[model samples]
Target: MLSAAAAADVRFYGGAPRRRRLRPRSCLASPPASGGGCSESESEKARSLLVERYQDGVSKRYTLDGNSKLQVHWERRESAVNTVEEEEDANSLIPQAVKDFVLPAGFPGSVSDDYLEYMLWQLPTNVTGWICHTLVTSTLLKAVGVGSFTGTSAAASAAAIRWVSKDGIGAFGRLFIGGRFGTLFDDDPKKWRMYADFIGSAGSIFELITPLYPGYFLPLASLGNLAKAIGRGFRDPSFRVIQNHFAKSGNLGEVAAKEEVWEVGAQLLGLSIGVLIMDTSGVKSSYSTLVLTWFSVRLLHLWFRYQSLSVLKFRTVNLKRARILVRSHVGHHVVPDYAACNKEENILTWERFLHPQISFGVPMEIMFDGEESNDMVDRLLKLYRNEKYILFVKPSGSRSAAFFVTFKEGATSMSVLRSLWQAHWLHKNLQRQDEVFTWVEESVLALEHGFTDFLKQMEIAGWDHNQIILKVPKEPVLVIEHPDQEV
Candidate 1:
């Protein structure tokens, strides 16, 4: 029933910890799709009792004691704890230095003007990215004879008309198509005027720009925006007490169906000028020109988005296009979604950890939207509805920060939250607030084995019998790794 978009995995790291030992817990698998909990099997129970003899770096043994209790013996902090507790503690990468905060510290930068100046620097960056991507893609396309110049006016004119169709149809589609669909929402009425005003502003901008193009493309562009505006009006209900307000009237819900008819009057005026320009130019579009136009559309779309902040995506999507190509990229699969990023729009651009696409041999840099972990967890929960998920926890310390988790896939982001919300895991496992301890990131132990080695290292590093909380990184790098691959 709630709006959906994010959250996956069971691994989570955060501030604070609980001093406790791990015990037999629920299996990693989600309850049988029936909204019911699943029980641990006998083999799973027996697996818990087997004595684990560590052979890598400082070797040790993990075994259940005579009283049927888990016990651990390591070089430092020897105490028996279950797999789950160890997995959760692996999250802690204690910061070496805690930074202080005070006034005029609204931004992390030394001065507010510095941040503004940095943003202004991005305009050149956008132009650069657009140039590079266009060149590379054009080169590749040409190599394959994708869009070559062919001198055939009859075919060229048809190509031009065919090429302009999506945008042209979309322009008209926005109004009636948008208006008809807008009625589905039953939002507050007072907010309608605000949305209407925003739409009008967007429509005005489009109208101003439309005249630059020819008859077919210009009106379609403007109309498309107006249709979008009409749709927006229905989505945003008006809360204004003045029922007499014209915008709240929702006239026929058409793009031209504004409270004041003059709104459309201005757009039509622009459209007329565009029609005149198309007739005067009388230029015919050749096949080459049509192909160029198509590529330009895709280029502008991606560049415009890159010009903005970060884009969001889902885990299940099968996107073949990679938006970025970082030189030393750390790619992975269990990435955060748009909802997790708390972005207003659900932009479906594959924001690969690929860093940025190289333009002029320099890494493309854009604005970084590293929303804090609290905000991330808050917004991400809306995406999961009675569905079980998993997560991989990558600490935010250094470029080579060690991957922290016991499971091959890592810990679940929701499991930690679910425990708190459901009020079950901590109490059941005896995690007291006073007993938790954290391992500083300065101490990245080199273990020999894989998941088992991580648990042993935590105990060997003196985090034994202590539930360490791994604080979620503000900017978590979403890169999946191989089971044996070093992170």
Candidate 2:
């Protein structure tokens, strides 16, 4: 019964089952005597049993005791060669330190969906822009007479004075430009970025020509420095605002760190190239060569800048984007989304001359010239009594008009958007025979009828209602008592 039980228990777990099981032999109950013929034969039997089990893919072993025990061991086979190959392929050749310096920690996972595309264009734009900027710096320094070392104290003093005065003018220039355009930068960063780049290139041109006018070096170099400073003022803050748009994961710090790394890398490369160019005989000495190279590079820089801005699909509604949506809806009866409007937007604001210019949050005093016409103001107020904003339109040119929107206190983003749509409707339908008041009246009526449905269509088209990019002026809100309203 014991032998039958042992044979029944001898089961294979991994390999195929055998039809017959071997019964425990008497050799399993006793230890084999050392150096004897019986012992040798028993050892051969044990070896043959293990070989058979291994061949069947189920390995087992036995020990000699009165009550013997059986042991079974199984291990999953590992394909180490394939694993090693996979590891090698996944690894990078860049040193860990360099990777840490160049990339944000937790990278692709840490950034927004638009970050990679932004950087793809930004890399070439920064590289080429820095190269041109470096060349401009080299030429400007040469024009300023500080390009090379000098031995004379008077010459050194003059160079020092020139550099200091030029920088002083630039510092003031930056302050003025930054203050003047700060609001516009936040409202329309994309258009301003293009403008800033072009202005910076103009500064480069100014600096490049300074060598020709040796007698007027101070004024020309200062002007160049001033223009470049204005460009920097606008470009830096505009870039910051644009970067903020890409931090969907709230990882602005990581995004900015990686951006700084790219900027520094591009600047270093530009410096290296500038050194090589300077080392070439007659490159810096010849103004024509420098001008030719700078102009060609400046063109490339502008093109890259355009390409970079083109890839950015901002969901926010700025004036240009709002105009696209309104025009599409009003003219074609089709609502376009943020992406479509962004693609249709002109980075240079060329459409500024084509359509009516819209200005938001104009002061009440300025709009009505200090309440000189109370009756007119009251009539206008009653016209838009249902709305939170007031619109005023006037002919700006022979072909174009200017639409000024002044918001009352407690106005919201929706109010501003509604006013924009109404203003656009007025722009499309206003005729020579239509009085400004009558046309505005018709626009208000249309707004009352269609604005809610317009908003629904906008929502359907993927417009972000919460993010209106229009700038609200800090001027005092309008307040005039109406005879018909309760105090």
Candidate 3:
């Protein structure tokens, strides 16, 4: 009878049918050698039987062992790759420029400083002084307007008149409030003197009228002394109380007061000047009044536009606000997962484009645990298993820092190795052995709005039919605008 182990082996290899049949040792034993030729033939038959068994048993076992090793290697490599990918994702979310870097530290200049300097430079010295005086006067006028009109704020009054009004009363209400009970005196010599007295020791009709300058012109002057006072007062207890009151009231009272002041000033100034010119020229005053009205309208337009631009420029350059914006953007890059894995981190550094000469410095390098060489090899093997293409680069010189390897989904190691050989050979032939050992896969073009334009540029550069390899899932692997166009 066959041994139990032999029967088990037979059953494992050939299944139950072979397991049922077993010969006794005496019956299965080979015949004794009779002579040279016959014995050789018997020996050969036994050898052949041994060879068939080894091929079916040992060879299958070896193949299974190899496959298991491959699977183990694949899992190990995938884990490493995933770790690197996660690190990269984390690095992209940091807004290194805004949060980590200090801007305006050396200059000692704030955004307000720059704005003031810019405004001062825009006007002539005399005009600038006049503007400063006007702004000071206007602040007093604004104060007077605030103190006089207790019912509603100016902003509220203006808002109430709009199609989508924001407050109770409108601009017309301000005009009415300022002149209600005929408080606004006629623009005559006697009234001018009275107005001058009310403005304290300034003692000039011009001082009372200074605040009536267009909104744009007023700020240039306002930024100098007027802004300084307002800014300081804004932070003070007294000013805050007034501000809080206006804010709570939706600013209708303040708005109405300023509007009333402006209307009274404009009407008085226009009528007085018109009457004076008409009396001197001996002409009917209608034409002069019309001219004054036209000038007022044009001035108002210019003033509004100027105010809009100034506010826009001021907001754009506000250092504190700009830093906040940069930090938010960089944070998205540093923690891409928190930002929902969007590739926006890749271009988060692009904000520097908005403000050139604003350097944030290089990003900090992330450290990895494994040796780069081993990691690279592991990556290559994984790519091969996936039937992807890979490129391996070895720099020639002793000074070379690193060897680069890149892989894509549809490439093979053999093809990549061939490209590496070509690069090495080219360097050698050109006596550019200094560049030896370095391998590079061509970086793919990133097209923004004009992908078609980039394709056309590639065609013009004689890149027809050249296969371009791209990296992913960072970006699209290939972008072919037209089948005939090369990426």
Candidate 4:
């Protein structure tokens, strides 16, 4: 047996000469447990080892064997397996290089929670729609006498000029449509998205039948391209609104870049498929095949478009959502959240036949019957003296009435929502043939007393009150100079 100094020297200096004396307990391992009653317990040993091992501020991973001996292995600190799975799932089939090029960095994280679901439906839809679009273009070109003559001639010049004029007309149509319905894109993106798709389908139909009426080729082509251009105008704006919705991380620029990349890739794939179809069936392909292919693909596009958009649960309050909320609250005395309202709403509801006709931002001239001294207008102005909006209800031949709400200059999104609720409540009461003055008074009272509670419920339900989706006109804003005064 060695002396205590000799053993200490051997332990610290690896059996060599000791450079200096040091405490034995400072090392990671405790001095081999001596067979004594003072031996450290397993739990106490683990605690001591943990403290000593982690004193450097670096976390070390370890496990104990059945004998309670500390066992450790090093590993890289990286993302959790589930997190990687979530990021890679939707793009699993895409190559890594392609994903890097087209998808935003930290893609799904950079977008909304619904981004993956929307893209899954959008991919297949865009691919098929582009294929159909390509087919229609080819057919329309053939009808317009593309590739028929190599050299330029008088007839060719005339045909070329006509084609150029067709494009010009289409451009004008786009501008007109965009100007007329521009606000709708922001106010109700989903509905406009559907309408744009339908219009595009109609354009395809027009282009499809061009070969049948070659004599009327110019008119048909012009009309087809015009509709298509208008659709494109609406489609792009609506898509921008949706992209804004999806950009959760303030990465709008990145999201837009990735969206363009996806669109280009889809277009390339679709063009390749279109070329395959063109090769398989030559230019002289029958009308039956062309018509059948166009119709089927358009139908598929619309279905997928609907499926993709229906999943988006926008927390904003649009006209349809407002109506749904008001109707539900009035009936059940409980307000549904954005998610519930979205599920109940339809994207393609162009006309609410069962419900009363409701219009927002009616021109002041129409509201006042083009006369400054109208008694009814005076009464309405007096009635809404304390409010930022004026409401007018026109009784119709049917149970349904036309409800119009015109916003004053200083009106806000919240005020617009409140006006909608008030109009809906008034419409409901009037449907029961309640006295008009009495119901109007009750509606105003309900709004004044209960709107704050309504807003609170909306907040609790996670509604984003800041984004009002009401469609008010840009021009002809009605200004109430004396908002505080009675008429």
Candidate 5:
């Protein structure tokens, strides 16, 4: 008889008894008590049977639960894993260099719709008028110098002269006649030679009659006055030669005509002066020259000066505006939420108020949920630290997909909070610097969601589960640090 203790021990260590073997008929008629020892052969046989039963139980459980089969089925279904592995050969789509370069801190709020409309309407007209005026003035000056004033058919020039003259003859024509005797004849050498001669002669006159005009008898006396008047008149608020002249005449049509003429005259004068200075020095005048010497001189001078002046003015006044506009444009690329808001009308007003707060170069971090392993997390942290930009962490199973950590300059956490408060409380500063983080948060989530969908679609297309990282939405928490700590 097998001892009870030994039988129990065998059952426990080896396996559960088989249903057929556990039957009463197969058991010993009288089982031994707890202390009764069994023969060595019986004990060994019992152990062997228990071991066989245990193996059989394990085989039954695996088949009934379907665990092994499911694993094999999954392996077969995921045949596209190889393809996904091939695709992931490149680490990230964003270039390492681009990732290394810091992104701008915040979004430049959109230009208001109204301001954009206004700029669209106003800038083109203003720029066109300025350009046309320069062209006409240059042409007329050349015509006058070459004794071919009649040849210039610029309607604008004629209108200017008629407007300026008291008796309806243009001021230049009247002045020409008044100073006719002192001036060299039209047939005289190019205006450049005459200018040099005049300068030499005027030097002697000034020495002889120093007290007559006092300090005004220099070569530039007449030309300088003209240039100064033109520059001042165009830019000065109080100087309204065209407007005032038209008002006094009480003729709207005449005013329009004179405005055109003045534009032409100014252009021509600048051109003529420039030609005399630049082209006339080395080139000698000749009879019957195919090129209209004076006209050519005037055109060249006017074109050169006009370009120079326009460029200078653009640099001085509009360049800053242009730069701000460009910054706004480029900023849109970095943070896209504000792109639609940057209309011209809005820009016109918003730029004035908000441009100062905006600065460039902010850091950003993107963390994905599937990368929750300790090693992966460390790698991401290392990547963020190496770049020296703020890290945004999105944990798995989080509602919000993005959150910003600290960056070097620009929006601090408090400042961002403040801007949010102000935007909610005050008039919407669409171009506000504070909104940059907000926009960044939204944009990252959007990108994350997009990446997620892309991965899913890839899976559906027969990709392996392990081949591509699936993005999971994670709770975003801001990690604040002391100022002394390195970001």
Candidate 6:
């Protein structure tokens, strides 16, 4: 094995942090015990012990006796000699190159649940660019003495509001109207996508693109595209699926490079056009004309691209968890409790589903004991008096009998959970069957973090830990991970 110092040392790129000392990090195979290195025999012994310990960790599920008590024994499921299967997967944002990048310590944990904040601050990328660009341009115009602002009032945007941005009221008015109108639609991904494409496309063009917008319309186009991306991401699960595809195998460095150059090149193009317009039109204010028009477009374009990169960066954050959660073996897989869990090997991939339901509202989940249901659906609907609840995460993988149902906003959480539970309880008993069932309230953060913990808990057992699925099949279960707590 290499020395700890040698293993920790890494050359920085392009003189970055040249003088700043790198904190030592080590991947030592064994805990440090002595003042010096262990003998060759001792090292070999440690290696063997590690192998044995790792093998032991891949334990099977504990067998339950007639009284439902744990038995210190193993009961293996029949090997799937003729069939093949695969594991479930969580979505990621970018390819492996950017996957190495770490997320902020308090990332999704710190992300707010305020819908209005998301709409105003995060949803519209072009608006973000527009606000930043207007402020910068108006200030610059004041410095050069271009438009109406005469004396002390010039520096502030409030004075140059008419000249620089006579559009905020209309834009904000439309935003509020759209939010109100959106309440009419139910939570259907297909319907949501249709609305997003039409609305987002129209909004981007109307709100962002000026007639002489900089970069010869390329920046405008980029902003429009980003707006669409934001819109789709807001309501469509498939939007995240596409983002995850970019993260899984796509090169983020190349993407970042292309976006950076696109911003700069587009801005330069706008500047050239502005200069041309000044020369051809014989405008007396040539310097002011070029600076005001082209610079504003370019600056806005750059900011738009910057905003886009920020979104991609968040998408990249998911990869950090995958590094620890996923483990592969030759012709097999590894997880926490493999001995008692499903060990059937297959060529099928359960991760990539075509129709992934994305729920934006608060969710109540029910895992029933049926393959497919109509009577169950009708019964549940009649029980709740036809209050709408969308089907979100379909129960698949090892536990394929369950289904996830989410209650929309304004629905009482306790009432929803209670109704679902009571119905399932009575239904199971009346059917005279010991069917597995559960009902729980879940959120986006809760579901995702639960999956994260599920993967990690499985990892603790061993590589072939498929036999030990982390989601304990019991009702009223909550798994909470500490914020900022080290895994």
RMSD for each of the candidates: 24.1, 31.7, 30.9, 28.2, 32.9, 23.2
Candidate 3, 1-487: lDDT as tens digits:
2124233212211011122332222112221242222233332332110000111111001001111211000001123655675466468664423322322222234345575466456658756775565445434544656322455555433422221221111223323322231211110112222222222222222222344564433333323323233222222322233233345458856865775797699799978976775575434546545455545654674455334322221111112222332233223312112122112222113222332112111000001112233233333333333222333333335543222223233333233322333323233233343432232211111111223443343344333323222111211011111122221
Stretches of model 4 off by over 4 angstroms after superposition: 1-162, 281-285, 351-354, 361-382, 392-398, 430-434, 471-487
| Estimated TM-score for each candidate | 0.21, 0.62, 0.15, 0.61, 0.18, 0.25
Tens digits of per-residue lDDT, candidate 4, 1-487, equal: 2124322211111111222232232123222343222235543453211111111112222333334443322222233753575466555788654554445445668778887788789989977985665555544665577633354345545565677667667776676766555546766789888888888888777778888899988899889888888888888889999999889899999999999999899999999987877666543367687667767777888999999999988878877888787777656667898889999888888544437566665533343343333245445556787787777666665657777666665677776778877877776777544345556777888888777777777778777777666644332244443233433
lDDT computed for candidate 2: 0.64
Tens digits of lDDT, candidate 2, 361-473: 55332344323333455467667777767887775455666777766655666777788788788888878533667777888899988888888888899886788766444
**TM-score of model 2 (CA atoms):** 0.62
Give RMSD (Å) of candidate 4 vs. truth.
Answer: 28.2
Segments of candidate 3 deviating more than 4 angstroms: 1-251, 282-487
After the best TM-score superposition of candidate 1, give how far the Cα of residue 127 lies from its true spot, in angstroms. 45
Give the per-residue lDDT of model 5 (tens digit) for 178-210: 232222111111222223323333333333343
lDDT, residue 394, model 3? 35
Better of 1 and 6 by lDDT: 6
Model 2 ranges off by over 4 Å: 1-158, 279-285, 350-354, 357-377, 392-404, 431-439, 483-487
Candidate 1 on 335-427: residue-level lDDT in tens? 223234223222332222222211110000111113223222212222221222212122333332212222111234323222121111111
Please rank every candidate by TM-score, starting with the best: 2, 4, 6, 1, 5, 3
Residue 477 C-alpha lDDT in model 5: 18
How close to the true structure is residue 371 of candidate 6, measured as C-alpha lDDT? 32
Off by over 4 Å in 6: 1-139, 143-157, 161-200, 208-255, 266-487
lDDT of 1: 0.30
Candidate 1: list runs displaced more than 4 Å: 1-263, 281-392, 395-487
